[model samples]
Structures are given as C-alpha cells and as structure tokens.
Target: NKQIIDATIDYTVAYKPNIAFYETQGSKGWDSLQKTIEYIPKECFTIADAKRGDIGNTSAMYARAFFENMSFDSITVAPYMGRDSVKPFLQFEGKWVILLAYTSNSGSNDFQKLKIDNTPLYEQVIATSSQWAGDDKLMYVVGATHPEEMANIRSLVPNNFLLVPGVGAQGGSLKEVSAAALTKDVGLLVNSSRGIIYASNDIDFAKEASQKAKEIQQEMMGYLDLLC
Candidate 1:
C-alpha cells in the first residue's frame, strides 16, 4: 500500500485488503491491516475484501465496522444471504456494495451456473439485485474469467461499475473483460492482487510490484482511450 501510495504517480484509485490475508495471522494481522490502511492516501479508494455475508442485525454491525468505522469506500458482499442481509451496506452515500455475481474461482460453477426458475443463478443475482439499488451505489463482482457475460450483465444494469478480479494470475483476459465491461466512465477495475503485490520475494519487492502495476495501468489507459 505504501509502495502504491508513494511509488506511483498514476491515478491508482483504490487499495483493497482481503481480510483473510490478515486474519490468518491472528490479532497482529488485523492490527497490521489497520496500520496499513491508515497510511493509504485519502484520494485512493480503500476496500475491505472481507466478503462479509451475515444475517439480520449482525450484518448491520459488520457494515458499520467497514463503512462507518474503517471508512472504506466500498465492500464486497455475498448476496446468497438475501437482499436484507446486504441492504444495510447500501445506506452509505458515495459508498459501493460490490455484490458477487459470477466469480472466477473454480468452484463457483457449483452454484452460480446452476439453473433456478429457468434462469442461470448468476443472471438471477443480477436481475434481482438491480431492483434493490441503483447503479451509482451498487457495483457487481463479475470475474474477468466471465468477460463474455459482462455485456449481458451490463444490459441488465448498464450504469453500474463492475469490480472485476482474476485478470492476472488467474488467467482472466483483460482485453476481453474490458471489451464487454467498459462503461463511458471507464467502469471496470481489474484487480491483480497476487500477480502484482506478490510479484517477487527479493529485497526490492516494491519496485517489482510497481512494474506489474504499470503494466496493468497501461492496459487500462488503452481502455480509457476507448472510452474517449
């Protein structure tokens, strides 16, 4: 995060801390995350990739922790728990609820691709979710692996930004995703977590990481040009 903050002059936008990466280390991990986030520039987006999906009031408090307390700009939410469980997060303005639509993980097919009421589960997720919130407040997690589906999802809700992951190490094609997902405002945020951040184990790791970021940014620049 400090590297991205200090190292790059580009409009890098956001930094996400996947909670599992921190939680696996216990309390110290959580503390480190807090410290890391604190150092992030106010201009850059900060996201808690907690993927928190709980029920009732329990869901509300989790929303407060990330949105109210941590002051994160956006959060990833799982809709399987139902819209009620996810709606509490939508109450914040200028904050985004990145609802999981179709993910890149190999096991996602077990449920996401399954048919329900004659519609694919992911399509149903997009259809049902489009009703709960407008595009400005709600974004969807459409994995880069399913770039072809992005256009279909957009046809459902054209104005929303799609927080796309799996572009780098996961072999998701950025070119294809951008082709299907780009909005007039350059809507897709193609995340390259492990591929960029963990690029090297050598002492000058941050420099190597920046190189990876530069590569992605150039590709994004091309997409931005497409918007123009």
Candidate 2:
C-alpha cells in the first residue's frame, strides 16, 4: 500500500489491500492504508482483505466498518461462523463478499482440505456459500496455487467471480489455473502480488509493475477471446 499509487491503473478489475499488512504497523499504518485505498479509481473495485472471522452483530459491525466507513467495494471473509456471520456483508448493494475457500499458503491444508461427510471442506464452502446469495453478490478466493483442486471448485460454483492469488512468486501454474478456473464472463481475477507490484526494487518500479500487469492482462484477453 505504501508504494503502489499507480498500481490500480494497471489491468485489474480490483485492488485488494489485506488489513493485516497495514495493521501490523499500528494506527499510523491504518491511516496510510486508508489514504492509499482512497487513491484507487472509483471504477475499479477495492477489497478490504480482512478475512474477518466473527459472529452475528459483531460481524455486522465489521461489515459496517469496512463497507460503510472505510468504503470498500468488497471484503474477504471467513465463513466458519456460518450464514448468520457471513450474511451481514452481503446486505450492502454493490458490495461483494469474497469468502475464503482455499488459500495459497501451505498451512491451508491444515483445515481447508479436510473431508466432512464425503466432500472436501473447500467444496462444502462453495456449495453452502453459493446458497447465501446469487453470483453477483458473492465470490470466492480459490488460490491459483491449488490447480488440481481448481477444477473441482469450478464445477461447484460456475458463475461467481473468483479472486485467485499465488500465481507468480508462489510457483502456481497460470496455464492450469486459467484452464481450470475460468468462466466465460472473465471471472478469474488472477493476482500476482510480489510478482508484479513489487517487480522492481529500483526507481523504475511502477513502470515495471505496469508492464507486468499489461503482460498478464494480454494473456487474460487471449483467454477471454478463446472462451468466447
């Protein structure tokens, strides 16, 4: 958030600023984050990557804080607290909830891949959460790093948009992720954080970032054409 003022000018439908990155630095960090997000174009979606995990009225307040006060277009939420906890965020029109289904980190396997009854936990998340709202109101975070399982998720919620992470620095296979997770509506927002945004450490960082973003976007355009 400190460096990427022009980052949103690149090819992306949205820019997600995970709260953890800013909060770790305390109140001053929070102020910087708000200012940084305020710089993003209104046409581009801005997500508060809070992954907030709480219940009921408390969750509602969190929703209010991000969507009402912070004024974000979307938020990342953990659905473990069930429908009641997750529904508050969906109450606002033009706002989306990108629920965490599968994540990029190795520790994700600790719970996300677990089997309950017969289906994998991630599969269950897709199924249950799809029932909460229609595709336009909700999306999911299915990491690009998990290509083998990507196909399964696509089958589960075919229409909703997916915010994918871990494509570049994490060694995720973009080809496979695109093949498995794409929808005809250009629903895959593949995120390359360190790969593009931090592409250069020198003075030419933003230029390099834009170049990398364009390269990825061109690939998206190609996929879009093929899918059409």
Among these predictions, the greatest lDDT belongs to 2
- Which residue window of length 10 is worst by lDDT in model 1? 2-11
Query: After superposition, which runs of candidate 2 have C-alpha atoms over 4 Å from their true positions?
Result: 1-3
Model 1, span 1-228: residue lDDT tens: 566556543647778889888899998987888888888888888778989888868888989988887778999999998988998898888898999999989888999999988889999999998899987888888888887777888788778888888989999998998888787854777788888878887877778788888988998889879788
lDDT of 2 by residue, 65-84 (tens): 99988899899999998999
Report the Cα RMSD per candidate: 1.5, 1.6
Q: How far is candidate 1 from the true structure (C-alpha RMSD, Å)?
A: 1.5
- Model 2's alpha-carbon lDDT is 0.86
Q: What is the TM-score of each candidate against the true structure?
A: 0.94, 0.94
